[model samples]
Target: MDEKRSVRISKTLSRVLRHDPASIGITLDEAGWVPVQTLLTALGRKGTRITRDELDHVVAVNNKKRFAYSEDGSAIRASQGHSVAVDLGLAAAVPPAVLYHGTTGAHLDAIFREGLRPMSRQDVHLSADTETAVRVGSRHGRPVVLTVDAAALHAAGHEFRISANGVWLTDAVPPGHLGRLAR
Candidate 1:
């Protein structure tokens, strides 16, 4: 590839990985990492023809460290995709009042407090425990806390109900309230 051609691919890759290409009038989907077909199409439209071998070579040679291939190699994913995953499991039962999420402009905080109900049934994957709750919360820049005590919800006036194969029960708490219960 010529210097200018190589520069174009690099630029395209950066935008495609960092943000949805569709947002800027470039139509391409993140096929796991980078859709091979999309890359070829985009390149073709720009008067460049890229082969699968070239795609593989570009993926291999690029050293910016933002791209990754799925284990099955079906798709590609940018390291900076959308959310960050954190496991916030405090070994003991001492819960936190509020989970601190990402810094400024992290919109996940709102998602944690409101829950995913507004979106759709398919998006409603509530966090199962303090650990997962915090992670799910962090994805949007806010953390979540348990509403009731994990050890003694009944004693705390919560009716005991079990779902998730007898491990946990779901209940409601005040909006934006974080409970820090003792073990």
Candidate 2:
């Protein structure tokens, strides 16, 4: 598929898998997975009409690696960023001493004051690398990077998990554990 078409399909997939499966009349299991065929059928019912090959292509080429196929290739799920209630079944993992979160300047004051909350998602999304964080921030506006003291958070009994797409997940980041990362 061409780039624009691929991107459009990817966005639709993200909307369905990460945010609103019910919008298309499909329900994700507790672990946020739906049978591949069921998702395809639901998409068709919604008039999206994505084919198996097209779905495969979109999943394969999504820049963020947002979607993941089951080990047997019969199921699919978003790697993270679910707005509805569904555990992603990701195991806890130790994060590095530091991780990064990217956001627009508009949210900086609030973020520093209230700490980083999930907002609409399940967990505070973080990135192990500054580059990914910056890219994520750039989406909203002028990007600002915040270095997170992951080690401190972990030591404080906060669990961390790395998603299939490499995003770091934590319940929240306290203000004391965050610092502006000069970029």
On the 0 to 100 scale, the lDDT of residue 24 in model 1 is 35
Candidate 2 residue-wise lDDT at 107: 95
As for model 1, its CA RMSD to the true structure in angstroms is: 11.6
Q: Give the number of the best model, judged by TM-score.
A: 2
Clashes of each: 9, 0
Off by over 4 Å in 2: none
Taking every candidate in turn, the Cα RMSD to the unseen true structure, in Å, is: 11.6, 0.8
Best by lDDT: 2
Cα lDDT of model 2 by residue, 1-183, tens digit: 899989989899889988998899999999999999999998898788889999899888888999999999999999999998888878999999999999999998999899999999999999999999999999999999999999999999999999999999999999999999876
What is candidate 1's lDDT per residue for 63-179, written digit by digit as tens?
434455656765555433222221112122322222222112243355446632313111122223556555445566544343433234333553323222212322333234334
Please give the lDDT score at residue 17 for candidate 2: 88
TM-score: model 2 vs. ground truth: 0.98
